[model samples]
Target: MVARSTCQPRRGFCFFMSAKRPQSGLLAGRAPTVSADAYHWRMRYQRIDLNLLVALDVLLAERNVTRAAERMHITQSAMSGVLARLRDHFGDQLLVPVGRTMQLTPRAESLVEPVRDIVLRVDSALGTQPDFDPATAQRHFVVIASDYVSRVMLAEVVRRVAAMAPGLTFDIRPTSEIMLGELEQGRADFLITPAHLTAADHPQEVLFDDTYKVLACLQHPDLAGGVTVEQYRSLGHVVYQNERGINPWFEQWYANQYGSTRRVEVITHSFTLIPRFIVGTRRITTIQTRLANQFAQSLAVQIFDPPMETPRLTEVLQWHRLRETDAAVQWVREQIVAGSHAMPPI
Candidate 1:
């Protein structure tokens, strides 16, 4: 056996303490074993109430103590009590009054997104109901959206709804104004909007994506492939308007990027009528393929290669979870899905 003082470490510096083990020579005795209690020593702690996290999230969103308390269906005094408990647990004032209003302290600000995510996770795991059937269903579904999706996608959604559930009905609500009402009443069923809508915009899902193509009356023979900046400017067109709002974002975007807009002859919200209008005039408007094709069937319009730099089209489907399981609503959604699929993939 080697002398204890002269033994070398396995690697690195020999500054560490040498741990002891039973000696190499026929063991005189076995090493003493440790007790299980040593591994179970207690530390200072108290059980935390998780429901407080939900309250804190609501408080942060409302900001006003009274309003926050109302949203949680709790008394203002109780809200203050919870706020105090939050401050004590965090060891700082989570919110402090500045002038006449409360402002989130640094710690409260950091907890905002995390609290929201946690609340959503808990609800997702434990909150949803388990049954839906359309046969005996009685519910009105409201959908708010752009006219373009209506012409292209909603026609299919409508057709499917009519075919599958003749008893149940839908209120194809137009305009974005109904978003809050639909969400508040739990009435909005399926929505198709860009996926980037704000959280306040409502709960939604990305249904599908589409792209832009130039819609011209087949008779408009002066353009093909890329409609040059000058040629685009020279075309007479029907712009869309909703009580003064410009047509689709594509129109404004194209004008800004190409230096000038097409000469305007009419502004109408009736997307179906645009093709009819263009059919008889020298007007050409760039529109989505959905409406363009719908128009092409009757309006004699030609789909041209989109002028190189147009935004990718996205036809996203969104819906509220309240009626997410309703059978009739689901049939409508499926019809939309199928109808959308029927169109040749572009």
Candidate 2:
């Protein structure tokens, strides 16, 4: 399920946690707890709404309701209402109009620099900085990963994270065309992607290198001991495509090398769906060997080495350069890398 909370940016950070899979490790089934220091801090600020600090900073900086509203993505009237609330809260006419222009009052002027400093301090405190502690952190992580990675690795990742920090939650989103935007805008904490899809600026490390295997239903008649290049291209294929009509990386590479293409009988957004789709059909899909082995355990899927030579699939863990120094993010990256290494190779 997804968790949602509301407040202004930086003042009160909010996110959703969607881990449909079972939690792993020793911390499974236990309720998350807040540390005593965090509990006491919450109590001290029980009546204080920190969101107003953001409005105050903007109001003082711009000294114009419309501009401040534009900056805050709120309406001018709403900004005026925030000013009114600030006036009541601070007992000061924070802004005074001098003809057509609004000027900060003496009290507002006094608060201007301090408000900036306080907001900065609070943001630094709330951020996943270099001093982050996973043991007691109430952190939320957003990761964009392919279905294969999510199925083959996310469970283990969650297990490790839960074992260390029960209070942390993960929001794993599917890989999409706009994935880079999510990373650039700080919406996603990390992106698990193949080397071909990696962005230039993001700091990344290879999580694992996997080999591809041809997966088909066990009852497939066309596939016997091994697949030939001709049979592979002639057989109906199920490809993973985030966008309609686009093929998977392997298929594109095959077409480039052989100057021919497979008969794509089905194109689905998820690699996990290929197993179900290929069942009782002649359709064959190329998938990471690790994932193919996983699906073969439950599904009646047969794995085979493809006739054509293929390169090892290197999946990388990438984060926005801005978060490279973040201790929590760094730790999460390390744990994921460790989890990938700990997995038995296929």
Candidate 3:
């Protein structure tokens, strides 16, 4: 005999409770009354396969069934079947066709962060070991940082760690507007960014602080006597603009401090390219002193004190709060901190 649940229908799987007959008893065939809430809660996950969560996470990230299948190392038809099952279980088409590409449905979009978080938590829980032996443990770390940070700090950290941990590998991704989102989603093991831009919820430590410096071509006539506030405003500027068309911290600060007084002649996405754009031109750019000093080594650019005082750029290393106690993460953090301390003074 079976008892029906009085609970309202929900989106996920449903289960019914059954009662077995007792041996030769009066109430043998009679079904027992079960608390609807208790039964529902107990059987909630019984019918659902936890593996589908992994599939759903990949499907939602790629949005394209073919691409998702490629990432999951399954055939396209198998991924289609998974998608069909997901749609049926969730009662929604998670990814729908939009013109030539697929677009995430509203429900799917809302689930992106939570699903990624769940998958990451599960991976971390299962993959973490009681002890981390960097020399023998095989691990790949993902770091998200700007080229400036990579050139100035992370490159050295990687070199230093590589000699000690031969089995360890690294994937350094460029910083973007969605960098914090990537960190939150656990795609990045570490995020090196400006202190002010770091997520407030995460644990972060200052890597280093650098003041701004003016960069110009060595042959520039106007800056021969050093730059003045009036000359700085009048000179053509080569500025750094990220791929997302967002201005860097100093550019934003300058605009706020002096309005639109400086004229932007060239805008490039790469910080390393800023000096190249200023060469042979009357243009000047304001960049971090550490990076300016680096470019001065190879490029024919001279660095000068900023015509006006600017806020110091404090680069910071950050990680997900959940990873604070991760042994491997802690080990890497220690190495990075030590590397930062060993950097040459600007």
Candidate 4:
């Protein structure tokens, strides 16, 4: 029927009414729902019935209400009601029981692939995708190293960062704990250390290689230029130890080379205090070159060439496999390499 213009301001606006009389429309004897206004008002608020898809999918897969409900973690009665709704919606007996078990009809079988495709499409469109940006990243990085290496290059690292990337920062922690798990589990970003860790521990990079040197008090006439294998053996010695004794190989090599044990008169695990011991006395000390240069400016100890040859020490840069791909970490490695090249020989 034509709508009467209720007294609204718009001239063309008028509500429309369903022309169908009772007993002939979609709801049989119910009142009509018509016009864009009435249709939208009803359509916008209608609750979707998701049970149709659930029951249809389960029925096609299981072909039995009780089994489908068990698969869905619901009771059989609930599934029975769902199956009844599905049958009514499709206007077909989708599943038929024969003898002992149920089977899907042709119509139900045809719906399987299409239903699965629709569910997959919906999932793909709704799933989240993650992105990582370096400039705005506020991530904590932990590096493990000995106090020896830390003292040598850490200041340069910090200063270099301020000039290059003011936004990035790092923390270097020293510990002798087994670190493979720490790196594997994302606890530490990298490690620069002297000890030879096993292969299972972490990925690694060779930072720089170094050899031994003798730093003796310049006042000692015996060590004016360099100490002999004989003089080095006779002179009082200072050894840096990680725990109890210095590396057994270093000790063995010292003995094997000079046919006498090193005169390790004083032993301290702390390298920081070694300079004070060598500076005031006529004693001689053997140490790594980086420590020698660091002490050169402050102490009267003169760094001289070693009288005997020894194996070079490999100072490695190590990290958890996870940090290997990270840009900030890569930059840190590059800076370390650059700064290490400038370090004096041992």
Candidate with top lDDT is 3
Clashing pairs in 3: none
All candidates' lDDT scores?
Answer: 0.57, 0.71, 0.75, 0.58
- Number of the predicted model whose TM-score against the real structure is largest: 3
C-alpha RMSD of candidate 4: 23.7
lDDT of 3 by residue, 1-346 (tens): 1122233211111111112211110100112244454345326534555457667877887789998666555578877988888899889999999999999999898777666555554554444444778788666678898888888889999999999988777889988999998777666778999887999877899999888999999899888889999999899999998988998889889889989999889999888788989889899999999999999999999999987889878899998766766677778889999989988886
Error of model 2, residue 140, in angstroms: 0.7
Return whichever of 1 and 2 wins on lDDT: 2
lDDT for predicted candidate 3 compared with the true structure: 0.75
TM-score of each: 0.55, 0.66, 0.84, 0.55
Which tens-of-lDDT digit does each residue in 227-292 have in candidate 1? 666666678877776655744667766767765556877778865667777775667777776677
The per-prediction CA RMSD against the true structure, in angstroms, equals 20.7, 12.2, 12.2, 23.7
- Residue by residue across 1-346, what tens digits does model 4's lDDT show? 1122222211001111112211100000112224354345235423425335634555676677887666454568777877777788677888888889987788778666554333222222222113334445433457777677777876677677667656555677664555554443334567676546534545676777766778887676776656787887788988766674534335556667665566778777776788788877877777777778888878787888887787667777776443344455566677777877776554
User: What ranges in model 1 sit over 4 Å off?
Assistant: 1-130, 177-181, 184-187, 197-201, 224-226, 244-246, 321-335
lDDT per residue (tens digit) for residues 69-169 in model 2: 76555567777888888899788999998999999999898776556544433443444344657788666678899888988887888987898888778
Clashing pairs in 1: 134-327, 134-328, 191-318, 207-317, 210-313
Q: In terms of TM-score, which candidate is stronger, 2 or 3?
A: 3
